[model samples]
Target: MAEKPRLYYFNGRGRMESIRWLLAAAGVEFEEVFLETREQYLKLLEDGFLLFEQVPLVEIDGMKLTQTRAILSYLAAKYKLYGKDLKETALIDMYTDGTMDLIFLIAMLYFKPPEQREKETELVVEKAKSRYFSVFEKILKNHGQDFLVGNKFSWADIQLLEVILMVEELSATALSKFPLLQAFKARISNIPTIKKFLQPGSQRKPQPDDHYVATVKKVLLM
Candidate 1:
């Protein structure tokens, strides 16, 4: 039997959720190592365990992997979550890259001061919906498929689902206008393994409340 992979990240989902979803979908048993404190993260860095000096590190087959997309790509290929062929993989890569671009915009909002967050978030949300969301919806429509690549679920779909969930959590609104994207998220969530991972008692941590949006509010009161 192959040795199970072990994932390292903070308690929150952050960049690790897509990889987690992939693992669950693959039905592979893996261990999650949560570094809940600065000390733990620093110690790992000191030990040179993280090649990229980041979390969401995966140890498998005596090899360590880092980077969110890189890890997801490797796992997707390993477990056949990567699409059916080279052409499909290229499309998957394109969609995944686009999703990451949106994710970066949201992350930037978190780092802004409280006074600027609302205005910034609103602008970013509008741009994301108009640009990124529209593109994804069009892709689904063009392909006449529920998934971004081919007709089956792939890592691209998982990444898209994670991006949607993150945006909804940050904005507290659904993508009502983009019905196809909304439906895509719903379909991915309903996958048996993904559903199981989402159920109560799952090890996944609740999204952090002290995130940049909330922190800025607190800072302003002081």
Candidate 2:
């Protein structure tokens, strides 16, 4: 049997959380090595595991892979979640890219100064609703399908679901205006694998708190 993929990152969700979600959605079991100390991170560099001195790395298929996008694309294709053809693959990529943009904006909120955090949270929620979520709502309404791209469960759908939940964490009513998205979220979250991941005691990480923020700052020397 092939070994499970080993993930290298901090305990909290940064870029690695999406990778974790994708793997779980694919029903693949993997192990995680948390970087709790700067020494551990430096050790990875010394061992030449971090090619660019960065993580969200995966050791899989007898190869050590870095770069989050590259890792996600490889996994999506390997698990047949990418698409059936070039056109479908293109659409999946487009949708996934847009979700990443929104995810980045939400993640940055964790690093904001306390005084500015509330203001930034409101801005992030507004941008998510106006700029990103609205685009997905339109896509779902026009596609009128169970899943995005070829009406099949693909990486695009997974990415959209992940971002939808993230936005909701910031503002519970974030999806109130988008009926299609609300339905889409309900449907996708009910998938057997996804449902399991959403339950307690799963690999899924909770929203970042003060401890997570501090660990990240310490490990990265920020």
Candidate 3:
């Protein structure tokens, strides 16, 4: 058995992707147990041999940890990828949660029926985009760095990228109003580690059950 960090996360590659990016970026080896089917989840649960609790559980040999976001934060901290200044860490958290909100709103809007989506977007879309983009716009305005916090690449950068991709996957014109945000994503996206992680060969490709993936597929068909 290899002594690599083991991560039990969604096979569809949801929130767990950024964690994979961090590990891949660090050249850290680990087991990836993917769960994208109910049968798979049930079978894993039925097999009592599986340790720890949740799907996104990460086992560091004898030590097992859980939670998707927290796992990435721990890895970022352990690898000195969290950025230099304490203030940078603070901003990272702020931007990360902000980006998460946008992704969440997209899901909520999508789950709603046509009439409901109309009723909801009046308050959701603008607020979601503004709240998320405001923090990012501020970061780009203050830091010429390729990433969200300070001058180094961090988890927040990946989180923001996911949000932009998710939005674009929902609305192609998602970032048209904010060229800086678009440019920022384009810049951060080409980082060697992130670029490799997002390559065609990587299993990070979106899946069916994925909300954004399904939406994009629907758009393409129309």
Candidate of highest TM-score: 2
Model 2 / residue 70 / CA error / Å: 0.4
lDDT of 2 by residue, 90-152 (tens): 999999998998899889899989899999999999999999888888888896998988999
Which candidate leads the pack in lDDT?
2
Q: For each candidate, C-alpha RMSD in Å?
A: 4.2, 0.7, 5.8
**lDDT (CA) per prediction:** 0.77, 0.93, 0.67
- Misplaced by over 4 Å in model 1 are 211-222
Give the alpha carbon lDDT tens digit for every residue of 1-222 in model 1: 888899987555567766777788777878888665567777878888888776678998788898988888899998988878789889888888888888777766655677998898888878878888888898888878777777888888877887788778766565988889878888899988778877888765566545523433342232
Write candidate 3's Cα lDDT for 59-111 as tens digits. Answer: 77476666667777788888777867789888777777677666667655654
Error of 3 at 132 (Å): 1.0
TM-scores, each model vs. reference: 0.85, 0.98, 0.75
RMSD of 2: 0.7
